[model samples]
Target chain A: MKVKEIMTKDLTAAEPTMTVRELIELFYQSGLSSVPVVNEEGRIVGIISERDIIEGALPGYFEVLYGITDMNHLSQKLREIEHDRIEFYMTPEVIKIEEDEDDLTAADLMIRKNVKSLPVVNKDGILVGMLRRIDLLKDLL
Target chain B: MIITVTPNPAIDKIYWIEQLCLDAGELPVMRATRSYLTAGGKGINVSIFLARMGIENIAMGFIAGETGRAVERRVRDEGITTSFIWVEGETRTNVTLLERGHEQRPIQITEQGPTVPPDALKRLLIHYKRALNRARYVFLGGSLPPGVPTQFYQELTHIAHQHHVPVIVNAAGEALAHALLEKPWLVKPDTRQHTEIAGASLKTPREILAAGKEWTARGIEAVLVSHHITHDLLITCEGAWDLEARDVQFQNLLGAEDALIAGVLSATVQGASLLEAARFGMAAATASAESEELVVTDRTAIERVLPKIHIEQLL
Candidate 1:
C-alpha cells in the first residue's frame, strides 16, 4: 500500500501567523493533538503540537519554586505570548514524506525520526495529506 | 450592515450548578437546573445584541473543525448572517461554570483557537473587504488566534477606514494598543485593559478621564472604559462624558460591553450625536445587566433603565 492509501486525506494545516490563542481553539475544536504549519504557497514549513504549546507556555522553574503563583500572574504570562505567532514556537525543520511513498517507507521514516505523524506532500512539495503512526499499526494488523 | 469579527470564536458552554467549592482532592457533587451552550466571541456577542435591537449585521471570522462549524451554525440560527473563513483545525470552546449559590460567581476556562495561516488570513481579509462594501460599522472584538499578527486589528481598522466605515474595537493590551495607532472610531476597554495600556493605575474616574484624554490626543477618536458596572466613562474628540447607571441589580454582566457597543452603534447609525450614543449605550448596558440573557432585546427594558443612566460632561 502507498502512503495515500491509508493516510488521512483531509488534513488540517496552520499558518505561521496564527497566535497561540487561535491554535488552542483549533485544538479544542478539531481535537487534533498537532497540526502541520503550511505557508501561503502550500509548502509545509513547520509543525506544532499540544506538547509544544505546553512547553512554550511553561513558566520558569525558578518562578514556581519562589511561590510566584496565582491566577493573575499565570494569566499575565499567557497574555504576553498569547498574541505571539505560531512560527515562534513551532518546529520549523519539518520532517515530511511524499504522497507517492510506500507505507513501509512512511512507517520506517516515522520510526527513525520518532515522530507520530508525517506530512505527506506531492511532487511539487505541496501538502496533500498526513500519515499517522496509528495508520501504520492498523495496516500491520 | 455592521460587520463584527471574532478572529478566535468559541462555543461558550455554561454549566449552571449549585455548591461550587470543593475540598482538596475531592469533587463537590451538585446538580444543574439548566445548562446551555451559546456561540461566543466578543464580535459574535456584539452581533447577537445588535440583532436583538433589530440591527442587521454579519458575523465574520475564522471557524475550524467541528466546534467551529457548530459556532457558525448556532450564530446563523440566531438570524445573523455569517461569513466565516473555513480554516484548518477547530474553533475553541470556552467553559463557564456558574455557581448560583456562591453569589453567582463564575469560573471560566478558555481554549485557544486554531492557528490561521497566511492563506486563510488573506481569504478572511478579502471577505472582510467585500463585507465592508455595505458595512456601516465594523466591530472588531476578542483576542486574535495564534499566527495572527499583534497588529492585526490595526489592519482591519485601516480597511474599514478606507471604506468610510467607522470601526469600534473591543480588545485588550497589545491588540488594543495596535488598534489605537489606526485611530478606531471608538475603543471600549474594561478598566484593567485600559489601565494596562495607560501604564498607570487609573484608580479614580478622574484618572481614567485623563488617560482617555491622552489617547484622544494621540489620534484616537474616542475611548470608553467600563469601571466594573459602577460607571462607564466615554471620552471623545468632541468632549468627555461620565456615564453611570445607579440602583441596579446585576444579573449577567457577560456581554454588557458588547451590548454597550451595540447601543452606541445603533444610535450612531441613526445620525445621533456621540453624547446621545453614549447615553443609549449606557442604558443598553444597564438593560443587559438586568437581564438573564447575554444582551437585552426588549426596548422597554432599555427605556426603563434610560432614566437611571446619568451622562455628565467633564470636558
Candidate 2:
C-alpha cells in the first residue's frame, strides 16, 4: 500500500501564530496526540506533540522564586517568553513523507526515527494528509 | 455491553515495499518503502471496525511485554476502550510486505505468538467470566497460544451459555472443533479454514455448502463460510443462501474476513434478518477487497453494490 492509501486526508493542522492554549484545546477536541504546524501555504513547517504542550504549560520553580530573585531580570524574561510564538517552541525538524511513497518506505523512516506519525506532502510541498502508525497496522491484517 | 476476546493478538507491522522479492535479503532496491503499526488480532480488528461503524464496545485479551504496550497504545489511540490482562511473555508481531505494482499481493509472515502458562490461562478465563456478566455478545477470535488448552474457546462458549449470552466464534483448528461442541450462535470460518476443519478438499460452492450443513446439524447455529469467488454462504437455523458478488477491481484482501464479521454483527445488532446480515457481510468484504488499504466500505460503496449482490435462498 502507498502512503496515500492509508494516510488520513482530513487533517487538523496548527499554525505558527496559534497560541499554545488554543493548540491544547484543539488536541483535546480532536483526540490527536499531535498536530502538524503548517504555514499559510499549507506547507508543513513544524510539529507539536502533546508532550510539548504539557511541558510548555508546566509551572516552573523560577516563577515561585520571582520575588526572591532579581525583579527586573524576571520581568524582562517573562516578557520575552510571552512574545515567543509556537514557531519558537515547536519542533522544526519535521519528518515527512510524500503521498505517493510506498508503505515500506514510510514504515522504515518511522521505525528508524522512532516516531508515531509523519506528515504526507505533495510534490509542491503542500500538506495533504497524516500517515499515522495505526494506519499502517491496518494493512497487516 | 459487548466484550471481544482475542486469545492471540499481535502487533501488526506493515512494510510497503516497491516490489516484494521472494527472499527478504535478496530484494532489489528499485523503489522506496514505508510502514505503520497497529494493534492487530481478529478480536481487535472486530473492535476497531465496530467502533468505526459507531458501535461502542470494549476489547478484552491477553497482552505481554513491550509489544503488548504498543498494542495498548495503538488501540487507545483509536479511541477504543480496552481491558487486557498482561501475561508473562511478549506479544507477537506480524509482518506484512505490500508490493506496489499493477498487481499487489501482500506477503504475510506471522510469528509464533507468545505461550500462555496454565496459571495465566486460568486467570484469563476468570476475567472472561467477569466480563461476560455484563456483555450481551462475546466475540472470540484468533489462534490459541502455546501451552494453553485447545478447548479454551469451548470453555468460554460454555461460560457464555451459562450467562445466556450469544457467542461468536472466529477460529480454526482444534480450537474451532472444540468450540463447535458448545453450539455457538455464530461461527465464521473462511473457505480454507472450513476445508481444513472438515478434512475435505472440496473447492466447489456446493461441496462447501454441504459441509456447512453438516456443521449446522452438529449444533452450530450458523456457519458463515467466506470464499474467494463467491460472496459467502450463510447456513443458519432458518435456511442456507448463496451470496454472489458483482465483479469489481480487487485491491488488497487483508482484513476482509474481520470486516465481514463486523458488518454482520452490526446488522444483527440492528435486528436485521440473517440473510440481510449475510448480504451486508458480503458487501463489506467486497469493499475491503476493492480498497488499497484495510478499511470498511463506506455507505456509498455498499449501496452501489448492494443491489448487484445476488442472494439465492437454499433450504
CA lDDT of each prediction against the hidden true structure: 0.80, 0.74
Candidate 1 chain A weakest ten by summed lDDT: A59-68
TM-score of each model, in listed order: 0.67, 0.65
> DockQ scores for all the models shown?
0.04, 0.02
What is the per-residue lDDT of model 1 for residues A1-141, given as tens digits with 9 covering 90 to 100?
A: 988667764336777988998888667755678988877656789999976875577635354455545657656667788989989989999999988889989988888999999988878787766788877888789
For each candidate, how many residue pairs have backbone atoms clashing (under 3 Å)?
A: 23, 13
Question: Which segments of candidate 1 are over 4 A away from where they belong?
Answer: A1-141, B101-104, B192-194, B198-203
- Pick the lDDT winner: 1
| Residue B301 C-alpha lDDT in model 1 | 83
Q: Is model 1 an incorrect, acceptable, medium or high docking prediction?
A: incorrect
Candidate 1 has an lDDT of 0.80
The per-prediction CA RMSD against the true structure, in angstroms, equals 15.0, 15.6
